[model samples]
Target: MLKGPAGALHVDDGGKGGVPVVFVHASCGNTTHWAAQLAHLRKRRRAVALDLRGHGKSTLDGGGPISVEDFAADVDAVVDGLGLQRFVLVGHSLGGAVTTAYAAAHPDRVVGLFLLDPASDGRVIPAEQAAGLMQALSTDAWGAVIAEYWAPMLAPSRPEVRERVLSDLRATSQVGASAGLGSLLTFDPVTALRRYKGPRLTVVTAFNQEPNSYQRLVPELPSMQVDGTGHWVQLDAPDAVNTLLDGFLSSTT
Candidate 1:
């Protein structure tokens, strides 16, 4: 545990070797969310997983509603505390939004980028749906809503994967998730990304794996697809995701 701007943050350090890869988990998620990615990536390079301010081990009681900046601050603390010179930033879902914010603000510190089925443009998540989700959280109905919505979308095939996803979602604090969702609404990756010019790779589910799915992120940041996976592509196809990351990291000459 390290005392960051947001207090003590739970960070999983994979030791030293190659350029470090910092993994960020999605909202309503913890360090465990990146279990597969860190496990595989760490073998080759220093892979680190962190629990955002309000998630997992960093579950501090106060943090003024989660926002991209808040998430970025956590990463800031991690990087500074660890004395990392340069590293690759990997974020999933909401974590990707935070990664974009960080890379935009600190492009020099980042050597590479990977956004895994992340939520970037506002159009990605319907306004009506976002409002409805917040309303559900307001009513203390997160459990029911998670089963009804996310389970089918994220855990369609794998039973064990589904359970862990739900467990993490439920473990997430309602306050943090709701605020983070609102922040996502105001997030503009297009603007943030404009500041950061580095090797880019955007991985998305095979279903929505196309130029249009990423919209502006397409030509700016070359993208790829993970077959037979959902939003939690890392959980469903870690090997495929690992292969993609390895290829991108090694091929970047």
Candidate 2:
């Protein structure tokens, strides 16, 4: 575990040294969420996953306001602490937003970016749909959101994956979800996506599912859709995700 501005951030930093990879999980996730990726890729690179403030072993209790800047800073702190001059930065869900912001802020340090089912762009859902999403993400669902979201947001093909995600989600700090999601609404994806030009790829679950914001990158952004999975593609389809991830890492490096 490493110390950040807020508190202790549980980090898994092991494996042979090569190009380092730092993983940031979704809003309601912890370091444990990236276990499979770390284990599979560790043999070749220094893989690290950090629990964001208020998630996993990190403490968010009574912490100051949480925003995209703070999230990005946490990532920066980890990178500096580990002495990784340059590395592959991967983010899932809201973490995608964080990674994008981080890459923008420190383009020299991020050799590539792998965004997993990040929030989209160019269109906002109807008020009714947005309300439903808010309701589903209510803190009350922290304990049961996994089951509720599994069928709708994840693939039925990976029940075990869903369960594992559920464990980490339930352990996340209650404040973390709302805080992170709030940033999703306010942050400017278009502006952020334009900030960096390093090798970038966005992975989604279905064809044409890449965030509309990222789509703007077009030929510039090489994206792959690993389906038979959901938002948590890394968990539902590790083999496919790893295949894509490995290729991206190799090509970018």
Candidate 3:
């Protein structure tokens, strides 16, 4: 575990001396969420997953305001602390937004990026449409919120995959869910995407619940879509996600 400005980040390091691949999980997620990917890819490459502030082992009992930049800074701190060179940055959900912002802020540090169901374009549901979902998350069905919202973002072929994602969702606290979702509501990574020309690929689930914010990037970036998985595609479709990531990493680097 490594300490950052926000809290202690739990990281898993694997592989020998290849370029490092660091993963940032979505809101309400911890490093454990990336277990499937870690288990599969660790033997071939160096991999690391971080628990964002207020999530997982990194708790913010009374931390200051949490901005997208602050989250990006935490990522920067980790990379610098590790003395990593020639690496790829991967992010999912809100972590996607953080990775994009980090890549934009420090383009030189990034060799490529793999964004899984990323939140770069911002919330697709309007404030009005999200009201009900928000209320449900705050009052009842917090776990359901994670499942339902991501259900639309995943491919429909995987029945067993849903349970794995649900387990992680159930672990997220109400305060973290509300606060983390709130942070995502205000973040917009469109400008950052435009500025970054490095090898960038975005993987969107076939049943994307949010609007096609990924489309907005088509003009400025390179991206693709995967089926049979949800917003938490890494968990629901690790094999497919890994295939895409391995190919992308190999091509970009």
Candidate 4:
């Protein structure tokens, strides 16, 4: 466990040399989400995956609304604790927003940014829809609501993969999950992304490949859409994800 602003944060650090890479799982997810990536990347480079505050084995000590900036602080804690000078940042879903915030604030510290099926824009969630979800999150219907919201995203995933993702979401803290969604409403991905002028790549599923998506919004932003996968692209198609990551790492690092 590494000491973070919130509390003890769990981190899985491995491998030896080459450019270090830090993996941040999606909201309500843990380091296990990156098991395949870590196993594959650690062979040649230092690979580290951390459980964000209020998720996995990490502790959520402070109270009040949690913002993307707050999540970014967790990344800050991990990199500082590990004494990393510059490294690659990989995030999924909510984690993508967090990594973007971090890279924007500390551009010099992040050599490369990789987002996998991430929440790239606030516009993706309509205000009315966000409000309704927020209300449901405050009641017993939170779990059901979350499951419903994630149902379509898991359609292309394998049965076991889909079940495991749902199980993780169910086990997530209601407070944490609610706060995470709240953060998305206020985060400005375009602005944050513009602040970071570095090597970056956005990998998305068919769900986020819409015309108004992140890549479309920022035309110069490098991105790739992987077919036959869902929101958890990393888990649904580990081999493809690994291949893309390898290419990104090779070109950037």
Candidate 5:
């Protein structure tokens, strides 16, 4: 029953009244991707996890050419639909690009932003590299794409975590994954980040998988390292991310 610009936003809401905190997932990820964070933050603050359009249960009206703006608009539509005023934005990878665009578009509405292994304009893979990656995806019939991408984002703590991550990814529809990849490949959030006036925190993974452009673009912005995690830091090291999130949100609030 979540109405938005495109259509309904598939979301999970928790907590009573405090500042609302929204969790935005990376490409190919849905609301379930933020399960760990939602469980941790919802107890203290209003937490909402949204499944981006074309992903999860969200239904879209005439899916058009995908772009970063489209994703940002969906998020804004959800916020407006919920009648939320001030809130914190937590974005991962492709979600970071969307949140950056949204915050820039509505600077006054965003109190803070926590980016987990965000992608950047400067760090985009060379056209050839991207083409190769795309080719790899096309070649894989069974679609082992998730494993290739999720390697760096997991902690060595438990073998069960790997199985869980794979299961969560497989739960998403292939159509949703491909559609999201279309938008992600074209998104560059470096310029968008420059436009955000709110407090920002970028959490880099320990595997050195983060783009070098992020290092250059966010020179002044404070960043922390999450040991033994990949692009999906929340999944690999939820406790550490939660601790960092709690501190950041507390300071900003």
Candidate 6:
């Protein structure tokens, strides 16, 4: 366990040599979300994943509002603790936003960025919609609302994959999940993307492929769409995701 801003953070480090790949899980997710990638990448290069504060084995002592910067700090702490000079950063959903924030702040350290169904278009939600969602998250209907919101994204996933993702989401602390959504409300993905002028690839599920999505925001941004998978594309189609990772790593690093 590595010391994090809030408490101890759980880190899974495997293999050695080559530029390390540090993975950040999605909101309400744990390192297990990257199990497939870690297992595959460890055979060739160092693979690292961490459980952010309030998720998995990590502790969130303060139960207060969390921001993208706060989540990025967790990544920073793990990176420094491991003494990694340069590494590939990968994130999913909310974790993707954290990756963007970190890359924006430390572009020189991040050699490549890989985002899987990342929550990158923070500007899409209007103020009132964000407010309503935040308010709903605080009510007793939070569970129902969350389930409904994510149902469509999990439509293409297998039964077991859907159960695992939902279980992880349900296990997450309400405070952390709520605060995470709150942070995303104001996250400036465009600015962060512009700041990190590094090799980056975004993989989106068919469910999230929209006209004004992250890839569309930046016309030149490299992205791939994986059909027949849910938002958790990595878990739903591990081989495909790993194949893309291999290609990206080879060309970038």
Full-model lDDT for every candidate: 0.78, 0.76, 0.73, 0.90, 0.76, 0.88
Error of 2 at 93 (Å): 1.1
Model 5, span 55-143: residue lDDT tens: 77787676445677788888988888888998999988778888888998899999998888776563366788766665665554424
Report the lDDT of model 3 for residue 65: 44
Q: How does residue 248 of candidate 2 score in lDDT?
A: 88
Per-residue lDDT of model 6, residues 1-253, tens digit only? 9999999999999898788999999888999989999999999899999998888888887766788989999999999999998999999999989999999999999999998888857667888998899999999878678889889888889999999988988888887778777788778888888899999999987766676577878767788888888898888899999999999999988
Q: List candidate 3 stretches off by more than 4 Å.
A: 63-65, 123-148, 154-159, 209-211
Give the per-residue Cα lDDT of candidate 1 at 44. Answer: 66
| Tens digits of lDDT, candidate 1, 1-253 | 9887766899999856888999998877888878878888777678898888777888556645556877898999998888897999999888888998999999999998888988756546777887877778677776676567565457544878888888877777777666666677667777777778998788877554444344345466787666677678888878888888888789652
Candidate 5 lDDT score relative to the true structure? 0.76
Give each prediction's root-mean-square deviation over alpha carbons: 2.4, 2.9, 2.8, 1.2, 2.5, 1.2
Least well predicted 10-residue stretch by lDDT in candidate 1: 207-216
1-253, model 3: which lDDT tens digit per residue? 6778766766666775567889999887878778887877778777887777667776555533466777887788677777786689999888888898898888888999888877745465588766766677677767666666666544463666666556656776676666667666666677777667789888876554344565454555666777655577777767888788889878976
Structural similarity to truth (TM-score) of each candidate:
0.89, 0.86, 0.85, 0.96, 0.87, 0.96
Which candidate should be chosen as best, given lDDT against the real structure?
4
Misplaced by over 4 Å in model 5 are 61-64, 120-123, 132-142, 155-157, 208-213
Backbone clashes in model 3: 6
lDDT of 2 by residue, 77-191 (tens): 8888888899999999888888998998899889899998776652355567656665666657654654564457755557787777777666665577666665675566667
**Model 1: residue 182 alpha-carbon error in angstroms:** 2.7
Q: Which stretches of candidate 1 lie over 4 Å from their true place?
A: 123-132, 207-218
Model 6 per-residue lDDT at 245: 92
Clash count (model 2, backbone only):
0
Give Cα distance to truth, residue 233, candidate 4, Å.
0.8
Query: What TM-score does structure 5 among the candidates reach?
Result: 0.87
